[model samples]
Target: MNLLWLAVMILALSIGIFLFSLRWIRRWIREDIQRRQAASGKLNAIFEWAERGRQDSLRGLVLPGADLRGADLGPGQEGEPGADLSYSNLRGANLRSVNLRNTNLEGTNLEKANLRGANLKGANLRNANLKRADLTSANLRDADLRGADLKGADLWLTSYNSGTRWPDGFKPPMEAIRMEEE
Candidate 1:
């Protein structure tokens, strides 16, 4: 009689553990599904906002490390090139320490932006409004700045190579500038 009772207790304990484990597994699955749903909703919103180029309203809405490469920001004119910005407004945006090699920035407004320590090698800045932009320690090697407004733009400690193209008859400011050997 005692042996039978012990066996029954053991079976009950095993069943209890199994039931608890199943509940835990279900909870984990439910949480995972919820997380995926939330992520999907956020992605949908990002796409909607990017498609419209809603710059002024994207201050806090743009996700971190957003991928906006090859996105067309707006209409381009003769001598101006268009490109994808990857959701960076860059209006007075601090691009210091950022590498933007070969990225298109045609007709983007970069007025008063801080581009210190930025690398714009082979990037297109055609017709970009860069008035009063701080480009200290920036690398503009091989970048196309045709028709870009550089009035009062700081080129302190900036690097320029022979491949870098400047606006018609314009040269990089001669203040603490470096020229790369061809």
Candidate 2:
């Protein structure tokens, strides 16, 4: 009789532990799935907003791969492209592989963002902040940079084709010549 009682208690304890562990695992999995879904939703929202120019009225949104070709993005505008964007905030955004030709970005905030392999030919960037950003393989030909801050920014393997423009009366560095070889 005592042996039977002991066996029942052991079995109950084991089942209880198993149930607890299962719940914990399930919770973790659910949280992970939720995180992924949120990230995907944010990415989708950014694209959708760029297409329609309105989504929850998010101001100064960072849009990657947006075609701002001749879009008027001046001050007090709805974050239009290729307009005077001095003092505009764009921290930690992905502008990778974008065509920002002739866009004025003077004194803009672009900290810790990914501008990798982007085209900025003839764009103005005087007094812009680009700290800790990935400008690797990006084209800044003929763009203005008289007082731009590029501390800790990556320029590795950046691109620069012909007909590229520079800042006001400024010339590209000798290292920039390597882009021509590619």
Candidate 3:
């Protein structure tokens, strides 16, 4: 009878321990997920604030070398304001090696911006002013550049696939063509 009691106690203890451990693990995972979500929300808020400042004609809004992948920087739609960087002065900004895929840059002034090795795949740059911008070795695959001004811009070794659209009658440099071939 004593042995039987001891066995039953041991089994109950083991079950209690297992249940507690499982509950603790689940709590830890939930807390971790909440923490990550908070961080993401903070980052998005900062981006939105910066966009607002830029829209208010605040010059030199520096966001160079920022990881802005999948960020919506387009004009507002359906009463919701998106990030519109149009007419914003971004001269001499360091945007090197950043992912700007699918970003909107219509009519934005990017004069003398350092966009070396930046990935601009599928980005909309219609009517954007890129005068004297340093685009050395940048990836512009499938980027739309209709009506964009590229006067005095350096296109050295820039890569553009077949889907890339240039301004009307604009000719790509020899290096760009060679990069596409390779």
* Among all candidates shown, the one with the greatest lDDT: 3
Q: How do all the candidates rank in terms of lDDT, highest first?
A: 3, 1, 2
Q: Which candidate is the best by TM-score?
A: 3
Runs off by more than 4 Å, candidate 3: 1-84, 177-182
Q: Could you give candidate 1's per-residue lDDT for residues 90-145 as a string of tens digits? A: 56554566656665776667777777777777777888778898888888888899
- What local distance difference test score does each model get? 0.67, 0.64, 0.70
Model 2 lDDT per residue over 45-73, tens place: 64565466432343344443233323323
Q: Can you write out model 3's per-residue Cα lDDT over 1-182, one digit (the tens) per residue?
A: 99999999999999999999999999999998886676567457646665664253222234432334334343333333334455655566667775556556677777788888877777777898899998998888888899999999999989898889999999998877433544
TM-score of each: 0.53, 0.50, 0.55
Candidate 2: give its CA RMSD in angstroms: 7.9
Q: What is the C-alpha RMSD of each candidate to the true structure, in Å?
A: 12.5, 7.9, 13.7
Clashing pairs in 3: none
In candidate 3, clashing pairs total 0
Supply candidate 2's per-residue lDDT for 29: 100
Please give the lDDT score for candidate 2: 0.64
RMSD of 3: 13.7
Judged by lDDT against the true structure, how good is candidate 3? 0.70
Name the regions of candidate 2 deviating beyond 4 angstroms.
1-81, 160-182
In order of listing, the candidates' clash counts read 2, 6, 0
